[model samples]
Target: MVEFYIGTVDEMLQSTLISAFPIALLIWMMTKQRALPSHIALPITALLVGLIQLFYFHSDGRLLGANIISGVLSVLTPISIVAGAILLNRVLAISGAEAVIGRWLDSISNNKVAQLMIIGWAFAFMLEGASGFGTPAAIAAPMLVGLGFQPIKVAIFALIMNSVPVSFGAVGTPIWFGFEALALSPSDLLEVANQTALINAVAALLIPILALKFVVSGSLIRQNLVFILLSILSCTLPYYALANWNYEFPSLLGGAVGLMMNIFLAKANIGLHTTQNTLNKQTKVPSREVFFALLPLGLLIVILIVTRISPLGIKGLLTSTNAWLGIDIGGSHLGVSQSLVVSLENILSTSVSWSYKTLYVPALIPFVLVVLISIPLLNLSKTQVKEAFFETGQRIQLPLVSLAAALVMVNLMMLGAEQSPIFLIANAFATLTGDSWSLFAALLGALGSFFSGSATVSNLTFGGIQQTIAAQVGLPVNLVLALQSVGAAMGNMVCINNIIAVSAILGIHHKEGFILKKTILPLLVYGGVAALMAIVLS
Candidate 1:
C-alpha cells in the first residue's frame, strides 16, 4: 500500500496507476519471456493489474465504478461503432460495393500513383472517418489485395494508413468518452482533444505518403517532392485548422478534401514505378460494372449523412431508448461512474445506454438502397443481396469475438490499475518531469494509452497530472496537455490489445510481435514529431 501527501480522494485514486506500473512491467516481461499466447497473456495481464489494485487500495464504490464504466463503454462505444462499420463494409463488399468504388476511382485516373494516393491516402482516410476501429485495415487490406499486393503486405499497408484519423475516430468516441469519465469541463477537454487529433491528422497525411513511396521505391520519392509536399501540406493544414474549429468532423471533412484533390493531382504524375504492377488487367472489374457495385455504399453514406440532418433523417424517424443497465455505486451511476475509477467487470456488468443515432435506422434503408438502386447500380440480383448478408455475418464472427474479449481484457486492467500501486509510479514520473514536461507529458500520455489501449484512458490517467505540473512550474498548461493527447494517440499504434484485435480480424494469428515490430518505428517517429510540435507550441 503506497501513501502520498496528496489527500484528496481523487488524487489518491490516481496514485494507483503509478503503483501498478512495476507489476505491469513485471507481467509484461514475463509474458514476453514465455512468449505467451495472446488469449492467455491478455487475460493474465488484466487479472494481475486488477488484483494488485483491489487488495492494496481503499476506494469508494463511485471511484471503482468509474473505472468499470470506461471498460463497459469501450465495448459499446468505439467497439460498436467498429462493428457497424465492419457490417456496412461487409455488406458493401458482398454486394460488390467496394468494386464499384474501386472502378469509379479508377475511372477518374488510370495512373498508379493517382490510384495509390486515392486508395492508400484519401480512401483510407474516408474509411477512417466513417468507421475507424479495424476498418481502415479491413477495407484497405482487401482493396490492396485486389490491387495485386500480397495479403501480408496489404495488411501492413492498411495498418500504416489506419493511423491517420484514429484520434477522432468512430465519431470521436475515445476523446468524447474520456472527457465524460474524467469529469473535465467539456470545452477545455474538447479543445485539447481536437488539437491533438489535428496534429495526428497532419502526420497522417505525410507518413502514409512517405511510407508508401519509400516502400515502393526509395529513390523515386525525390522525383515527386513537390506533389508529395503539397499533398502533405493540404491535409496537415486543414486538419489542424478545422480540428480547432469543429472537433467531430475534422478527419471526415479534411480527408474528404485532401482525397478529392489527391485524385486530380495524381493525374499528372512524375516517375515513380511500383515494383509490382498494382492494376490487375486480368481481373480488373470494369468501370461501368463497378458503378452498380458501389450503389449500396453510396446510399449508406448518403443515408448516414441525410438521416442525421434535417427533420427526416434516420434519427428523426427512429425510436430512442436507454438500453444500458448496471450497478449504481457512490455518486455515480453504473456505466458512467465505472469510467471514473477502474473498469472492472464493467464489460459484463456495466450499463448499456441505448442511444439511437445511426445503428438502428433499420438495415432496410441500406437493403433497399442496395437492392433497388443497385439493380441499375451493380446489375446484381436478389441472390447477390442475400449472399452479401450471409458473407458479412461470416466475416464478422471472428472480429466480434475478438472485440468482446479484448474489451474484457482492457476492463480488467483498468480495474487493477485503479486499485494498485501503479498509479503512484505515474505520480512520481509526473513529479520528476515537472516544468519542462511537454515531452514527458506526451510520454506519460502514451504510456497510459499503451497500458489501457484507449487515448481517453491516457488522458484520464494523466490529464490532471499535466495540469498540476504546469501550475506548479508556471509552464504552459494547455500545450503540455495537448502534447499528452498526441502521445496518447501515438501509443495506439503499439497498444497490445488494439494490435491483437486488428491482427485477429486480418487472420494474422500468432504474430502480435510482428505487428508491433512494424508499428514501433512509426510510433517513435510520430511521438518524436509531436514532442517537437509541443516545444514549438510551448
Candidate 2:
C-alpha cells in the first residue's frame, strides 16, 4: 500500500482543495435551487469521492474495499434505530395510542408553545442521552406531527433541541469513547465534560428560543416568555450541575428533572396564565388510558437507564462477548464474537474494522423492545402490527440508500489515513486560524459531524487534531476540546444523515435541503456562542 502526505505548502494547498471538492459538491447538489434528492445526490457525490481517492489520493483497492464494506455495515446502526422508532410510531397510530398521548399532552397544557417545550426540548433531551444516534428526531418529530404541528417544523425544532444534550449522549460516549485515543486522565476528561456543559448551558439559553420561532408566532412566544425562560432554566441548570460531577448522567438526569418540573409548571398553570382557559376547556384524560399510552415509552426509559447506567452492571454484560471466533484469510484476521457483540476486524486483510454491540445498541434493547411490548400492552391486533412493519419498511427504502452512500463517502475520506480529506480540511482551518483557532474549533467539530453524522465520530476523528492545534496556538487543551464537543453537538442540527433519517421517519421525502436550510442558522448561532465562551474561558 502507498501513502500520501502534504510535505510542501503547495502540496498542502492542492491536496486540501482536491479533498474538499466532494463535500462541496454534496452541499451544492443538495442545497441548490433545483436541489437533488439525497438518494440521488449522495451516491453521485460518493462516486466522485471514490474517483478522488483512487486517482488523486492514490488509494489502493484494499483500503477502498475495507472502507466501503465498513461504511455499508455502519448504516445498520441508524437505519435500525429509525426502523424501531417508525415501528413504534406506527403501532401507536394503529392502536389509537397516538391520539391518547396527544390528548394527554394537551391536557397538560393547551398552549402549543408549552407542549413544544416539553416534548421537543425536555423529552428530546432525555432521549438523546439514552439513545443518541439521531433517535431524538426520529422519535420526537412523529409525536409532534401527530399533535398537529407541521412535519417540517417538527423536524427542524427536534434537531435543534437535540444539540445541548449530545456531548453527554448515549451515556457520554462522545467524551469517553471519542477521546479514548488521547488517553486523558479521568479528571481531565471530567474537566472537558464540565467545560462542554458550560458552553452548552450558555447556548441552551437561546437554543429553545430559536427552535420556538419555527413553530409559533412571535407574539405567541412573547406571551409565553416567562414559561420559556423557566423551561430553559429547568433543563440547563441541572444539566450544567451534573456535568461537574461526572460525564455520563447529566443529560439523562437533568432532562428527567426538567421534564418533571416543566410538567408540574404546565399542570399548575404557572407562567401559562394566558392559556389557562384553553387548558380548562380540554377534557381530562383518564389515568388508565394515559398509563397504557405512555407504558411503552416509560418502559423504554427505564430499560435504557438500567442498561446504560454502568453501576447497574448490565451495560458490561450486554457489551461483552461471551464467546469469540477468529478466522484468518489472506493474512487478515476476522474475529467474530458469539454473544451480544458482533465485530468484524481487519476487513480484507486491511487495518479497517467495524463492530456492532447488539445489546448495547438501543435499537434492539429498548426501541425494539418497546415496539414488541406495545403490541401486547396496547392490545394491538396482528393485522395492525403487520401494517406497522410494512409501513416502516416502505418509508426506509430511499433513506437506506442515502445513508449508505453518505457513509461510504465519509469512510472513504476518513480511511485515507493521514491524507484524509477531512483531516486536511481541519488542518487548513487550524493553520489559517492560528491564534484564533478557538473561534473556529467548534466549527471544525461541526464539520466532522456534518460529514459523519455522529458527535462521537467527529471527536474520534478530530479530537487529537484539536489538541495539537490548541497546544501549538497556546490555547487551553481542555477548553478547545470542549469546543469540539460543543460544535459536534450543534452539528446535529444540520447533519445530512440526520436530515435524511428524520425525513424518512416523518414520511417526508425530498425536503432534506429545506430542513438543512432551516437548521444552519441554529448551528451557526450555537457555534458562535461556543466560540465566545471558549475565548472568555481561555
Candidate 2: RMSD to truth: 2.6
Candidate 2 off by > 4 Å = 1-5, 273-277, 322-335
Model 1 alpha-carbon drift over 4 Å, by segment = 1-37, 54-113, 130-134, 170-198, 201-206, 213-215, 220-225, 270-287, 306-402, 416-422, 451-453
lDDT of 2 at 266: 90
lDDT for each candidate structure: 0.57, 0.87
* Residue 376 displacement (Å), model 2: 1.9
Say which candidate scores most in lDDT.
2
What pairs collide in candidate 2?
none
Task: Estimate, for each residue in 1-538, the C-alpha lDDT of model 1 and write its tens digit.
Answer: 1123466757665565545664455346434644544555555555555555465555344445445445444554444444444455555566566655666655555544556566766766765555454555545555654554555555555556666666665455456655554466667766776668656755665576545642456554555555666665555566667777655666666677877777656644433233322444555567656655654655655554454333464453443433334455543333312112222242224332222233433234333344455554555577775675565455455545444445555554444342334446566665556556666666777777767766767777777666677667777766767777777777776676566555544455556656556666777778777777777667
Worst 10 residues of 1 by lDDT: 335-344
